[model samples]
Target chain A: MKVRSHRAGKLLKGLWLALVLAFLYIPIIVMIALSFNASVSRAAWTGFTLDWYVKLFKSKQIMAALNVTITVAVIATVVSTVLGTLGAIGMHAMSTGMANLLINVSYLPMTTPDIVTGVSLMLMFIFVKVPLGKWTMIMAHIAFDTPYVLFSVMPKLRQMNPNLYEAALDLGCHPAKALYKVIIPEIMPGIVTGALLAFTMSLDDFVISYFTSNTDQNLAMIVYSAARRGVEPTMYALSTLMFIVVLGLLLIVNRRNGLEDIA
Target chain B: MKRSWYAAPYGVWMVLFTVVPLLFVLYYAFTDQSGAFTVNNFVKIASPMYGLVLWDSLRLAFFCTLLCLLIGYPTAYFLASRDFSNAQTLVVLILVPMWMNFLLRTYAMMTLFENNGVINTLLESLGLERIQMIGTEGAVLVGMVYNFLPFMVLPVYTVLKKMDYSVIEAAEDLGASPIRVVSRVVLPMSIPGVVSGITMVFMPAVTTFAISRMLSSGMIYLVGDMIEDYFIAMNNRNVGSTISLVMLVLIILSIGLLRKVDPDNTGGGLW
Candidate 1:
């Protein structure tokens, strides 16, 4: 009786996992299936066709939004990576009290709700008479993304040997040279991870990007406006393609670093 | 000492972008249209109309967090269990959907829940009447659970994965039933993860503008949607900033609670 009960318990756990997986994936799978439906109406599938994919690529609005999204994400990632890495290094060299203060201050952006961040940034831009546009959007992305980079790099800095930099300096290396040759390489994994994380966050961000941009619509804003109006087959197609890219990138990152570090 | 100065540019940037902008929120929250300081914005939020919205947001977020915890606790347990041969692969599966664009995933839920959408169509073909799924509170709750479930699962899984299995073995060897082993031993050890998971799921679920907007077809209004409309649609930054300030306080309080529970910064640091 005890052995049977244990087996039943195992079966129940397996069933729960399956049920949850179904709950998570069914909506996504249904959406992906509808992207190939010949009719735009989600209810009726007259036949399967690739026309949505063709139209997705042909749509000027979507293409333009894609261009803007990539541009903003890349720029934000680059700027935040440089600034955050420097900041992390600088904080590492600080007194413990100073470093803790800086770290807590940095948590402000990460901890605050995205809408609050978005609205505050929007108000600030108007207060300073700066127009809401791609640049403001990029700036907001950098504000949120920098802390993540700083966090990712800080862990690596903690793990590095303190003697390595001193040894490089004692061997007659310039301070900057030691930083470049020894310190940077020691933290390269963290830097790369941080940059990738920044890019992903910038790409996926909608709320902050929505408030901070006026004329420039990224892919998320485009999808928001389009989804609000109604469902479009071409939008589904675009999402599938984007989903594929995200899945591939995550798989690569997972294989490389186990993905536990980032999450 | 020289190296510490390297953060000078970053410090300046943070002050300009992070510190100054938040001060702008505080300023706008207290001021009226003429930019003079006033408490009327807070007075406006105190009225029943906005008060109900706040109450509804709290209710929805609470349930969303509860449902996530219920669904996520077992999911995390199974994923973290040594009995599962492919736990790593399952973990990756959970994360892949999470990495997808936030809006796109919410939008995808609409396809399933629309009146003429997939579920209703299947029901119709079976000679059943179509049920109204969109523009309802339930739809919004489902959207919240769907989007934020991963947040709950990941943190709990992280804690459980690092948990020592020998304790469970010792409990079993000492004649403790499976129920007692989990209830007494497993549950106690997983509190930090559960707390972290609750924070992760609750915060985003509370402040989500997009999920409510897309899933409810604009019928439901959460705090996030309220802020968006005040600032964007109504052109009332004062009221919006006031609401945002309230949200910031809620966020700070929760983080404080989480820190008290998990002081060592485990469960992956809340971001």
Candidate 2:
């Protein structure tokens, strides 16, 4: 009787999990299906066509937003990755007191509310008389992105054998050469992970970008405005494309981490 | 050159961007339109109208966190208890939706919750009345639960997965019933995860503007929306800064409470 009850409980749990997963995916599936519907109205399905996808390419505003989004994401990722990796390495060699202080400072950005960050940064620009545009957006992205990169790289730095650097120095390698050859190779995985994370964060950002952006728009900003005005089918097409790219990138990352079995 | 010198650039960057920007917010929050220091900005939120907005935001955020916990705890518990070889795959499936653009995900919800959207269409076809759900408080709650559920689930699942099975077995051997074993052993063991999940979900849910804007269709207003209105719509930096500062204090207090709950910090990182 006990064994039978256990089996029954297990079956019920399985069903519950299935229901939850369905709830999560249903909206996404609906959106994708509606993107291909010939009708513009979300409620109607007047046969299927790829007209929205075709029209997506011709939309100049959307194209411009996408261009800016990709550009900002790339530049922010590169800049944050470099600064964060070096910062992690430098902190690794610091006295405990100094390192703790710096680490605490890094945590401030990540821990603060996004709205607070946005408002504060907006005020800072106003006070400094800095034009709120592409460069300011990039600067804000870097400010938030660096802490994540630092945390990622810090773990790898902790795991590395300190003697490896000393041994390289003893082997007559210059300090710069030793760092490039020894430390960089050892922390490459963390750096790559950090860069990918930074890119995704920048791509998906809306609040800070909303405040900091002057007249320029990113994909998220465009999507927000469009959504407010009743989303177009072309917006659906853009979402589908972004979803595919992100999914592919995540799969690759998982495979590299030996997590492909989960895929 | 000292190796510590490498940190100088980041140190300078943090001071400039993080420290100074926050100081500017504080400066703005305390001053009036004429640049004279005044307490009016802070005093304004004490009005009944503004007080209700703050209270409503907290109430909604609290309910959202509670709902996520109610749904996520059971789902996490079941997944962790299962001995199936493919359990990790299931967890990954949960995470995949989060990788999608959050705005798009919320937008997808908007499409479904529209007056004549998918759910209503299905209801009409079934000869049932089309209930008005969009622009309601319930709609905003659904959006919050859906968007933040994964944050709750992942941490709880991680904690449960790491729990030692031996303790559970020991409780069973001591004549504890299944329910007792879960309550006395498994649940306590997963407290850290639960705390982490609460902090993660509650922080974002309380501060979200986009989710509320899309789901509630501008009919409902939260503190976040009020802040946005002050800064963007009204161009009133002083009032916006005051509210932002207040929210910051609340968030920091919550984090401090979370640290107290999970003093050992076993469930620290979400990655």
Candidate 3:
């Protein structure tokens, strides 16, 4: 009797998990299916075709938005990663009170709702009379992205031997040379992880970009506006392509660092 | 290069972008059109129109959080309890959807709920009448839950995975049923995760504008939508800033209260 009950419980758990996964993935699956469908009718499956994917590449609006998204992501990732790594190192050497102050300030951006962050940054740009455009978006992205980089690098800094940099210096290494040879290598993993995170966040960002951008629309902004107008098969093609790329990238990262790092 | 000086650039950036922008929010929140100090912006939310939007936001967010917890708790518990082959892959599956552009996924959801979309189409083929899924409160709630469900799952799963299994065995040895063991021992230990998950899910669900806009077809208005409209559509920065401030205060207050419940402070480990 107990054995049967145990088996039944296991079945129940499996069923529940299956239901939840279905809930999560069904819409995504539908989108993928629709991407290849020749007909716009959801009820009927027409002949398979890649026409939408062809159109996706040919669309100037999408191409422009994609270009802007990649450009902003690359610039934001580089700037934030550099600034954040240096900041983390500097904070590691600071007085506890001073570091705490900066840490608290960092949390404000990290924890605040994106809408508030978006709104406030928009106001700031308007107040300072900076024209709203890609540069402003990059600045806003850097503001939010730096804290994640700092936090990621901070843990690695904590784990490193405190004397590693000083020992390099004692061994006749110049200050910059010591930093390059010892400090940076020690924190390289964190820096890479932080940079990847910054890149992804900037690429996926919509709310802040929406508020800050005047004429410069990223892929997300374009997708939002397009989705609002109507569902387009071209969007499904774009989503499917992005989904595959993101999945492949994540799998590669997972293989390198183990699933725990990203998840 | 001195170590302290390394952070000077970061400090400057933070002050310029982070600190100064927040100050702008405060400035606009407290000032009127001429920039003189005034509380009129705060007073404006007292009207029934804005009040209903706030209430709708809280209601939808509340239900979304509750449903996520209900579904997510079991999924996490089961995943952690059973020794599944390739458990790491299962967790990865949960996260892959998130890496897809947030706007795209929400848009995908809209297609499923549209009048002639996949779900209704399927119903029709099954010889059932088509149902109106979009532009409803239920649709908005589903959208919120769908978008934020992973936030509810990951933290709880992390906590449960770290929980020692021997405690459950001990409780069972003491004549506790499996349910009793879970309820008595496992549940208390997972409170930290639950707390953090609630905060994570609730924050985004409450603040979301686009999900509600797309899923509800503009029938629903949340605080986020209001903020977006004021700043973008109406160009009323003062009122927008005022609403943003109020939202911020509510969020901070709830986070504080959640921290009080999970006194050990392990609740926010997701950060």
Question: Count of backbone clashes for each model?
Answer: 0, 0, 0
Q: What is the TM-score of each predicted model, taking all chains together?
A: 0.97, 0.97, 0.97
Better model by DockQ: candidate 2 vs candidate 3: 3
Report the lDDT tens digits of candidate 3 across residue range B1-271. Answer: 5788899999999999888988899999999988999999988898999999999999999999999999999888888885576666777788677677778788889889899998898898899999998999999898888888888889999999999998888898899987798889999999999999999899988899999999987988899999999999999999999999999999999999999999877852467
Error of 2 at A1 (Å): 2.2
Error of 2 at A48 (Å): 2.0
DockQ of each: 0.78, 0.67, 0.78
Fnat for the candidates in order: 0.79, 0.70, 0.80
Stretches > 4 Å off in candidate 2: A258-263, B268-271
Question: Across residues B1-271, which tens digit of lDDT does each residue of candidate 1 receive?
Answer: 4999877777778778888999999999999999999999998899999889988898999999999999999899988887678878778777667787878888889998998899899999999999999999999999899999999999898888889999999999999987899999999899889988898888898898888988887789889999999999999999899999988897788779878987876664345
Q: List chain A TM-scores, every candidate, in order.
A: 0.97, 0.95, 0.95
Clashing residue pairs, backbone N/CA/C < 3 A, model 1? none
Model 3: DockQ vs. true structure:
0.78
Candidate 3, residue B122: Cα displacement in angstroms equals: 0.8
Candidate 2, A223: how far from true, in Å?
0.8
True contacts kept of 1: 0.79
Ranking by TM-score: 3, 2, 1
Q: Give per-residue CA lDDT, model 2, range A160-248, as digits (tens).
A: 99999999999999998999999999999888877877887888788889988887889889888998898688888888888887887
Error of 3 at A106 (Å): 2.1
